[model samples]
Target chain A: IPVLALGIGSPTWAVEAAHERGSLIVSLVGAPAHAESAIRAGADLLVAQGTDAGGHTGPIGTFSLVPQVVDVAAGRPVLAAGGVATGRHLAAALALGAEGVWMGTAFLASVDARPSGSVLDKLLAAGPGDTVVSRSDSGKTLRMLRSAWSDEWEAPEAPTPLSMPYQDILIGDLLGQILRHEVAPLVHEAAGQGVAHLTAQEPVAEIMGRLVREADQVLADLGTTRSASPASIRPAT
Target chain B: IPVLALGIGSPTWAVEAAHERGSLIVSLVGAPAHAESAIRAGADLLVAQGTDAGGHTGPIGTFSLVPQVVDVAAGRPVLAAGGVATGRHLAAALALGAEGVWMGTAFLASVDARPSGSVLDKLLAAGPGDTVVSRSDSGKTLRMLRSAWSDEWEAPEAPTPLSMPYQDILIGDLLGQILRHEVAPLVHEAAGQGVAHLTAQEPVAEIMGRLVREADQVLADLGTTRSASPASIRPAT
Candidate 1:
């Protein structure tokens, strides 16, 4: 079985446990403060997450966090994640020294993903700035589209969300009800800032392929050649 | 002197003023929503800005915003800005369809810039996540490094800042005091998220030349086979 590194809590014990079981460990947690601990605990790789990521995220952005983690890892491979949905983004991540890229928002927009039609529609209509990072949704700072539910939590009068498991348990039923009923206006959707970039729904394979192709094109453009073709290369008149 | 087509408030007004003055009008404000308005107002070019940018910015990131702006500009030159301080970033901006790139944060780090040494030092020390968008400094959401002042404003008891000139007037003295005494701890300094990537301060001309060279190399690698190498492109890869 593939080992999934959960980043929500301390992975030190988990890393030790995974090592004991001889399983590969992946950590999805945020916060650069944890990098030393994660490395000391024997995390093979690191996933640098941004606030624009769909799930739990540390406040630091990919632009700031990736290089720092790269410096800290001392030559270990780091995967860039959070709000990465396009080929251009993938190219940018590689340029930032990421060995590979992980994208949740891109997969969320895939047809096979569990999101409903309306949710997908809303995601497609959104832009990078349309999402907000708030803890009210899942007891951690998760990126979700700006909605009434998110706005309520942002309001001064709203109660602070409970800690994990308890908070998820408390609102799980309500969240399910909202998702099942197609009540987008009432439900708060956890998504990334990349949601706004999604103009349409495509299959996961197509999306991934497009991303790879685009990234290759970008990389090729940046490689040893100066211009793509004669038509693209204009001379000084 | 080059006549700057300064966008005052409305794109329509900006265009009319530029036409009347026989100057090249530039849109200074942000927001992708303004693209159509600028086009309707006869904009000759577009500047795609990202949220990571210093000063004023739109909600769209440079990656997502530039392509759309380029498409809408319909062959007009598009200049990219916001959080661009390195050769890699400039290359990425050009790859995304921008004809040229504009940089501000880099200039802020220059010796000619008027920022106090302490402010510059603080900026040099900050990481990308150190900066945040807060309306407390300016009525509009501007990006700045998180400092005691910004943290205080974020506190529950902080007062809502007055609009524009009023706030400027009210806080002008405080700002001056902070700067005069090098009380940087009391004020949030304006900068971009790219500051985290900068390791040293160098001459602007050298930095600019390096960026152009790097961009040329990147463009070459992108499958472009043009030979218009700038003086900065050193043969050794």
Candidate 2:
């Protein structure tokens, strides 16, 4: 059975469920307190997230939070997530003592990722400063390409974004219209600042290979050796 | 003699006057047509700015405009300005055929730099996704941290920023108040996302050295032997 990790859930209940199913417990969207509780409840691994990470992110940055989580995990392996897009970034994460890296935005630009052409184009054209973290669009402080919608919400005269579920419901139909090209002007592409580094659309394997090679070279030059073998570096678990 | 490159001046007479004083004609903010005219008027170097840069920037991005400006400069050296902060960024600029990188935001965080403490703190806490390009703050598409001021202006209910000198005048007192710590809460801290990389206060020389070292390592690993010599890789002229 596939062991899925869900964040922001009750650690005790999650651990009980995992034990009942004979599955592993992994936590997401967890705080330091939650991580401690998850460990107490028998989590197999801990994933520490930083704000630079796209999608759902916690308050801490990967650089600051990852090391803390690793220390907290004791002997258990810790996974580093959030903004592990570039090879250099991954190299930095490894330098921070993460057992492995978990990437989400890096996969978003892959040819198989299935985003729209315009969206992909916008991603390619974006720079590091072209993204914003706001609850305005998705109710979560998601990293997305800066857009007219975000711009409106970020403006002073505009009303603050609605809370979760309500905000999602309010923008849901507008998002549909945007995706259909009915609201072309309102369809703002969403991605992390790493979009600047994504110059082309290629397969996930190719991108992964490139990232590994680059990261390996960086690590070797930095004189840092990884515990895992070269082949094992890829899909680092 | 200090040379102030003026590219945005509309009056052709001013350009001639500056040229008469042996002032190297540098365009401030203008279109390609004005750039071509400045070149025709015996301007020494063309400083091509992209919209990604802080302070005064044109509409185009550095990645797109720098190469074009290099072409325009012909044999003359071209300096790239705007959004360049790190050694990796400098390497990218050189790879784009720029002779040197003209930086602004990179220096804004230095110990000698004059930004307010709270402003600096806000910048340090920000992530790469925390900035926005808005004319609402300064009537130009300058990159700044997303704050209540810009948000208000960007809101559909808010009025547009005043034009140019008028905007500058209107915001001058507010900016002064922010600088003095009297109204810091009311003003949005204007800084590029590069501010996130800075963790502590350091001298400019120290920061520059770190950037140079990191950039050198990156370039060396990339197998670009041309940048191996520190002397050859001098700061932008």
- The list of candidate 2 runs beyond 4 A from truth reads A9-11, A224-237, B1-237
Q: What TM-score is obtained for chain B in each of the predicted models? A: 0.86, 0.81
Error of 2 at B102 (Å): 20
Which one wins on lDDT? 1
Model 2 per-residue lDDT tens digits across residues A99-217: 66777777777888977876777777776556677887768677677777778888867877787768889988878778788354466654644555677888999989998887667
lDDT of 2 by residue, B95-168 (tens): 44456667666776678886677777766676545667777656766677777767777886777788776787
Q: A26-83, model 1: which lDDT tens digit per residue?
A: 6654556566677777777778776557767665555445556766768767777766
Worst 10 residues of 1 chain B by lDDT: B228-237
DockQ, candidate no. 2: 0.04
- Residues B1-237 of candidate 1: C-alpha lDDT, one tens digit per residue: 234434334456656665676665555435556666776777666676666677765455554566666666788667777767666676666556667776788777665675677787887788656887777666777788888888887887899878876877788788888888988587557777777765666777877888778666655444432232422211110
Q: Judging by DockQ against the true structure, name the best candidate.
A: 1
Interface RMSD of each: 9.7, 18.3
Give the residue spans of candidate 1 off by over 4 A.
A29-36, A63-65, A163-166, A223-237, B1-10, B28-30, B198-201, B209-237
